[model samples]
Target: WARHGIMTTNLAEAYNAILRKLRPLPLTAIVEGIMYRTTMWMRTRRAVTLQQMSNAQTPFCKKMAEYLQEKANKARFHTVITIGNIRQRWEVTCRTKGGFGSSTGVITHEVTLGHESDNTCSCSCNKPKLLHKPCSHVLAACAKIKLDSTSYVSTFYLKDRVLNV
Candidate 1:
């Protein structure tokens, strides 16, 4: 559970319930029941993914896009600076005030883009590490370069990837 980052017992309880029901059935019946349930789950997920893809967005992407939009709005006054000719490194500075009548403070973060094939990126805030998604700073840099935000997203969040799984 720790390896999978699961902090709740809901999944365990569900599995136990399923097992309890299946225990009364014959071997073949139990196998069939589990298989049917799994198939239905996969089918339902695939159908939803297809619907989302038709709209040109996966559920993950849509959620991340919303988060990025909110963060971008808050970061309206921030600036993005290109590091070099590589076009893979950028610096983003976010300005914030402690409180009313307080002096403004600046926090700078670096975003490093991944290889072209992967289309992934990371930021100094470590959000990408925890969430497995691009941070706000990375999105802000992408906006500055007029780059498509989706292009930097990991394929793991894509509909095609989910379908393939």
Candidate 2:
């Protein structure tokens, strides 16, 4: 299954609280303070990411790498089977997992690979196209064919792109 990141209004509420504290200040001073704070945040992020990149082997940023690894770990719980007449098309079925947070039952997805050497992957979940990252289904299908799933991942989450910020 694909993981969906939920972003709520808590961030805007926090920002509003900060702005309320600055409401009595002059508009020019408030704007300058916000700009300076944002600049410092970027600087701090860049420095920390630079250190993380130094020890990393993959091109993906640290978070992205961990996310992909989690997907791969989930992929191991899936059983992929070659379906239809095409070898590139596979059926990825989730194994029965019993736990407090597990799904109701086994679920299956259709994954079609347009090419073996390219990143053209279409899943029933449509996560790769929607999120620009390989979902567990894609990873399972790729593993069945001994293909690398990283090619299907977007470069936007790469270390180089994050470092450029």
Candidate 3:
């Protein structure tokens, strides 16, 4: 737009808004403000790149659409809590021995599988703080199913939460 000279009156107003906010400052203050906003923009761009890389699916753009759809379905958002075994049936349990100690209380957890945006559980435990790393409970589930303990998920996206809500 700038190359085509399609400038909008709002551009001046936007700059004015920033100037207005820093009107009482000295020269250094204005420079600092510009540098701060520039740094913020750069950081935002880098975060976007990292998130895109983490979320990339296989087979290029073709699979990318389906991968996004799967993510949209929010199929990976739920954490399976085993209360206990049920005589050949499925059982759920939430107890464990580890960072919280051997006799810790029932540790309820919120797992996020699909939604990448809000993909964090609010537990102070060592598990989710590691980000995408499986915790002890996930490890247990993987063992029960004879799979890699790290395969279990612990976070979700908007789709699952919205539907389940």
Candidate 4:
């Protein structure tokens, strides 16, 4: 799951459940049932995607942004330090509590913004690689600079790109 970034096996479970119900049906009946289910699934999914496009952010991106915002709010002791003459790099240090009664700790991460020609950025957390989305550290640095965090989000999570897919 980590290698493929699959968070769950719900799709496989659903397919297995459908197979169990189709086992006692005739061949043509099973085929018709599958076709009907697939058609309905596609229609419902397309409608939801279109509705999400009406918002400022895509559904997936909006959910990620909300999570980042919640984490940023808890990161009250965090600091964003810019580097390089052109400010192409940022070091974000976030202090977090360990547990209910444990001591606090500091975690530092580096985020690199590519040049205008590249239009790319990366975070040391590697969340973008795993989830194909911007990490909280990157969002925190962007917030410090008063930049739009959505600009850093991957195009795959954007409404237009998702719809195209």
Error of 3 at 132 (Å): 35
* Per-model RMSD to reference: 6.2, 5.1, 15.1, 5.0
lDDT of 2 by residue, 115-146 (tens): 74666788998888778898899999888878
Q: Which model scores highest in TM-score?
A: 2
What lDDT would each prediction earn against the true structure?
0.73, 0.82, 0.43, 0.69
Report model 2's TM-score to 2 decimal places.
0.71
**lDDT accuracy of residue 66 in candidate 2:** 93
Clash count of each predicted structure:
0, 0, 13, 0
- Could you give candidate 3's per-residue lDDT for residues 1-165 as a string of tens digits? 252223455676777786787767898998899899877876765554444544444212232334444532432332345443431111223644443643554455443232224433222343434543444444433344554322233323222231232
The CA lDDT at 50 in model 4 is 80
Worst 10 residues of 1 by lDDT: 1-10
**Runs in model 1 with CA error above 4 Å?**
1-47, 57-61, 71-75, 85-87, 96-103, 115-118
**Residue runs of model 4 more than 4 Å from their true location after superposition:** 1-41, 56-77, 97-104
Best first by lDDT, ranked: 2, 1, 4, 3
Model 4: per-residue lDDT, tens digit, 26-123?
Answer: 98998898899888887776676688777863345455556667766754456888875675789987765563333557777898876655556788
TM-score of each: 0.56, 0.71, 0.30, 0.62
Give the winner by lDDT: 2 or 4.
2
94, model 4: CA deviation in Å? 1.4
True lDDT of residue 96, candidate 3: 41
Question: Ranking under TM-score, best-scoring first?
Answer: 2, 4, 1, 3
- Top-lDDT candidate index: 2
Of 1 and 2, the candidate ranking higher by TM-score? 2
